[model samples]
Target: MFVKISHLYAENFPQLTAPFRPIWGPKASILLVDDKLAAQLNLSPDEILAALQSDDVAEKTVAMLYAGHQFGQFNPRMGDGRAALLGEVSGQNGMMFDLHLKGSGATPYARGGDGKAGLGPVLREFLMARAMAALDVPTTGSLAVIETGEQIWRDVPQPGPVPGAILVRSAASHLRVGHVQYIATMGDDALLSRFIEYVLNRHNMRADAHENMALSLLQNVMERQAALIAKWMSIGFVHGVMNTDNMTLSGETIDYGPCAFLDEYNPASVFSSIDRRGRYAYGQQPAIGGWNLARLAEAMLSIIDDNVETAIEKAQSVLSGYTALYDAAWRDLFAQKIGLFEVHKDDGDLIKELLTLLAKHRVDFTQFFAELGPIFLGEKKRDADNFAAGHFGMDLAVWYEWKNAWQSRRDLESMDEIRILDVMRRANPLRIARNHHVEAAINAYIYKGDDGPFKALYAALSNPFEQREEWDIFDAPPQMNSPPFQSFCGT
Candidate 1:
């Protein structure tokens, strides 16, 4: 194995070091290993298993120290409690990727809690990460899910204990805004400078043209995050936790805790069990994204320039660009979703009105877009009609009006119906990892030891855009009277 242990953060800031303790159990059955990533790394299943079981590898693992603003309050110290960075591996493309293990026992940052993960959350992240990738979303990739053959206590309604598991997550880098914030809070200018340089090199960010390296890095992160949040909004994905620690500087969606796709199109939908005030709700994500980036800007201000006042001014100036960038990306994405080849000023209003209608009728967001595929194709009126009735009930007058207006706008582009339908199909997915379905799969697996439901969901979500009759069951949302669904952080 051509493995390289960078440990850049640890080497620079020895104060953040934490030893990795091996997790002992009777079994470590590999649930899902990403073969594509394995091939890229020239690793076989046996090799991965060997690496997981090796105590030497565990000895080399390091837990990082960081701090973040959780629910708008700053925590001076927060770090990997149950996770540790094993090492880095250079892929065939020469890009370095971090192999991080979650549920790998306790570290110094465990904070009086057992450093363990439940099987349900591990499987959820594995499925959710793959599903997001299929939808063309940038996110951390799950390399594997290994059952630990142990049980952990959680707040789920179920009795006894939940099965434990470990998630092998791969990412470009585990660097987050909070990591910089931690260094900044420590008042270590030298450490911050080294950290900034490390990040620039890791992400291949050029700072020569910019007046300051900190400013350059901040701009790069801002633009990437703006576009990322836009993509999330377009697909109705609510990242339940938007803490500073959860925001990756690499622009990929990092944590999967309490994250979920929207079923009913409510602007105020919040799935994270801890977010009682809806600070990270669906409609609030973009703003929260900007806020998180601002925190990053604050952390880098000292390094942005020696003059504190000038640095503040420059950082705010860069921060001001976030809204405009986010708006443009959001508009462009919604335009594509609505089958608009070219965007006009009125297109925003049209999209907003449609969203208002969706929220008013409590329609399933994914189904609404997916049903539009057939409507644009002009192939299945009966299916479309059923969807309308199911979604809009007895009154669909507003829906018809919106449809007429949308068709008129689409027609003005003079594109073939086939081309428009193709665009719609690509923009909309027929299958999503719905909360209810995820819960059902978890229940089945934990209660009955049956992987049938989980496997079926995995297969359907793997090809989200494809239309297949067998996947119809995965298309629908949970019943209206079904027990209210809530997602947990599983920490």
Candidate 2:
């Protein structure tokens, strides 16, 4: 069945119809779609196969162009350097989304490096994105990844370094806060206006950005980012790098490089090798998200209003919503995790205490809480081996305290215990995109071309809420002294 990938194009993004080739910029591989998402989106299996092989697809993707500040330095020329928007398609629950191919190669924005990606980064994005979706966070999904059948050299030679990587990716839309920042810095106010309008009409356009609109767009964006960062925190997921370019205005989690879950809960935990100062660490994410929104606010100032002072005032006022949105979102999510339905005015304290306990115990964030489900955080038999044998760090005492509060709070045993268990299990995720597990699978598949582990990981993550005892390892954080693993700069 020669399914032409080009047929998937929905008569948009005319650039897609251009005479394309076997994408020759180092990484050149084909994508293939599995059956599950295909049926749900009404996307034919043939269309998925077509999208994978044919370089030419008739698409009218308005290949957006913009620049951004990278690492606090206004590069002023940052856009989709190594990515391309294939088009948008329906996924999960009938949501129309972006179908981009990462590692597709350099565009007008590729500023002189090998704009290629490796299999490691490709697999990392897939696992992290899928895990995020299961975690109930809005994120891009990993559609497919294939070996490009070519070599790409960065620093040191790694597995499949001889062969480059190819990835088929999915997202709500690749537009970012940095996307707006790019147009504004270019002083292309006309395009900026279009971009704003595009965002408003496509996504929920905030009244804030309008020229005469009442509610400020900056404020609405602030509220969105605030809520977003809170959701990230509730799950103990550190974005590692929260660069403006990586921050999508669509409020979807985009880049998944160097990102990690908090195995040992620490407010200052930073796993991303590039994040030396903990700038985008676990606790700092919420604040940094607000800070990034401020940059976005500056970019939208002109569009907000002609008068600079008035626009600045309006933007600042909107920024105030960051905390409240963050608080409300965090409280709500954390409360649900703990089986608390209604959030008391003081429920924030209870949530903080649980995190404090996790930090003190050095408990694997996913596993510790998930382990609570079998007993539902009830008493478990563990004298001191797991905790004291290694420096689990007084987690036993912390767990004891957490249990006392949790037990007292369980005011609904009369209610369906199964329902509560289901909620917690779904929230806990029987599987997470664990650091070592993903790394091991990527190494095996990319380096060895063995798809067994990678397929297994995808399978386990697909049913994160479903309790499958066989895939429990996918949920637990890997212990140290196993192997020294570090991520490369997927440039």
> What would the per-residue lDDT of candidate 1 be over residues 1-491, giving only the tens digit for each residue?
63444555556556665767558456878878877667766567666867756666677778888999999999989999899887777777988888888887877899987888888889999889889988899888888889888888876545458888999888888889989999899898888888888888888877663688888888889888999999999999999999999999889999898999999999899988889999999999999999999899999888888899999999999889999999999988888887887867798899998999999998889988888868656687567777777889987898889888987888788678788778888998988999988888877987898999998888899899987898889888987877666888887
Give all candidates' CA lDDT scores. Answer: 0.85, 0.67
TM-score list, all predictions: 0.95, 0.85
Once superposed on the true structure, which residue ranges of model 1 sit more than 4 Å away at CA? Answer: 1-15, 157-159, 381-387
lDDT by residue (tens digit), candidate 2, 127-224: 77777877778776677666676667666324334456766666666778877777677686776766666666556656556344323456556666
Error of 1 at 464 (Å): 0.5
**Cα misplacement distance, residue 102 of candidate 2 (Å):** 1.4
**lDDT for model 1, on a 0 to 1 scale?**
0.85
Model 2 residue runs over 4 Å out of place are 1-34, 52-63, 89-95, 156-160, 206-216, 376-402, 412-419, 480-485
Residue-pair clashes per prediction, in order, are 0, 22
Worst 10 residues of 2 by lDDT: 13-22
lDDT of 1 at 484: 60
Model 2 Cα RMSD, Å?
4.2
